[model samples]
Target: MSIEVSNESGMDVSEEDLISVARFAIARMNVHPAAELSMVLVDLDTMADLHVRWMDLPGPTDVMSFPMDELEPGGRPDSPMPGPAMLGDIVLCPAFAATQAKKAGHSLAHELALLTVHGVLHLLGFDHAEPDEEKEMFELQNSLLAEWLELRRQARREAQLAERDRRLLGKAGFFDA
Candidate 1:
């Protein structure tokens, strides 16, 4: 999967982290390998303009999704491969999302991760218009985020362990210093 991220918001947000999160979301959801995703971080003004033009809303939202080719989740390994497609664009307003992160008592990175997952789901045809739909979509979103975070933590722990082991080996004259 290819996830392109453009940070034009003029914020100090970590572009690498955003790209990693998008790649994780796409991979966990089993999206097609050839599917392309574009994530753009915009200023509030740009987000507001898009919010108005596309959604007819009056204010900038945290995130908005514009799907190109409607693609379904590839849940199974043997599932018939989907042809190359544009997974769509996920427009994020980092300036607006910062307020949300403060309100939610979480880091900006956390909020962005959640929003990224939400946007990807929207592109995959998930909606929360109804109560039941909201429950289903939110539950799935939360679960996906939780799982992805756990995976990240595990990877970090493993990396730390490997480094420690390497250090121990080096001290024991296991390799040329």
Candidate 2:
């Protein structure tokens, strides 16, 4: 998957993490490996403009998704043959998300990650307008985020252990080359 993230929010945000989460979400949803996604981190003013123009809302929102192609979750026995696609764009406002992060008692990075997953779901035709729809979408979104986080944690642990082993070997002159 080609996940491109552009941070134009004027705030220091982790573009790398955003891309990683997007890739994880798309892969988990069984999107084609050649599918392309774009994420933009915009400032409050830009988000506000987009919200007003697109959603007709008054203020800047946490995230907004503009899906291009109609794509359903692939890889099932009866699903369509997976192929390259333009997944669409996810616009995120870091400044607005910061307030939500404060209320949610989590780091800004975590909030962004959640929003990214939410955006991905929307791109894949998931909406939370109704109660049942909201429940299902939120459940899926939360699970995807949790699974991605756990995977990241496992990777970190493995890297830390590898580093520790390397250090120990170097100290014992076992890695001399």
Candidate 3:
């Protein structure tokens, strides 16, 4: 899928981080390369305004997804005839996400990654408006995020281990001797 990411509100988020998170989500979900998405990094005020307008909520949220396609007549949307569909916008508030991450006791980047996955799941027609749906959707999100974060953690661990081994070898004169 095509994930078009922009810092429209000058949020100072790294494009590298966002793209990596998108790549992880795409691989985890087995989404096709042609399925399109847009992620907008906005300020708290923009997010708060959007939240108020869209959900009738008064405060800023970490992330919100506006799914593009609605069920028409019976089946899928008209646009995605022979290819993956264009999912809609994911508006993210970095500031709010940072605050939430502090409360959640995780890195801000990690929290944002979770929110990104949540937004993408929404575009895939997953919802949590009902109790059962909420359980299913949130449990799925938690599992996916936990797996992803653990994968990253293990990879980092392996890399660090490799680096340590290399340094130990060098200190032992294995390379020089």
| TM-score of each model, paired residue for residue | 0.90, 0.94, 0.79
lDDT of 1 at 55: 92
What does candidate 1 score in Cα RMSD to the true structure?
A: 2.7
- Candidate 2 runs further than 4 Å off: 75-84
Relative to the true structure, candidate 2 reaches a TM of 0.94
The predicted structure with the larger lDDT, 1 or 3, is: 1
Q: What's model 1's overall lDDT?
A: 0.88
Q: What is the lDDT of residue 115 in candidate 1?
A: 94
Task: Report every candidate's CA lDDT.
Answer: 0.88, 0.93, 0.79
Instruction: Report the Cα lDDT for residue 135, model 2.
Output: 100
Query: Superposing all C-alpha atoms, what RMSD in Å does each candidate have to the true structure?
Result: 2.7, 1.9, 3.9
Question: Could you give candidate 3's per-residue lDDT for residues 48-156 as a string of tens digits?
Answer: 9999999999999988998775422122435546345666788989999999999999987888888888887787778899999999889988888888878889989
Residue 52 in candidate 2 has what lDDT? 99
Residue 56 accuracy (lDDT) in model 1 = 95
**Candidate 3: stretches off by over 4 Å:** 69-82, 168-177
Give the per-residue lDDT of model 1 (tens digit) for 20-83: 7778778877887788989999999999999999999998999999988756787335546654
Query: For model 3, what is the alpha-carbon lDDT of residue 58?
Result: 97
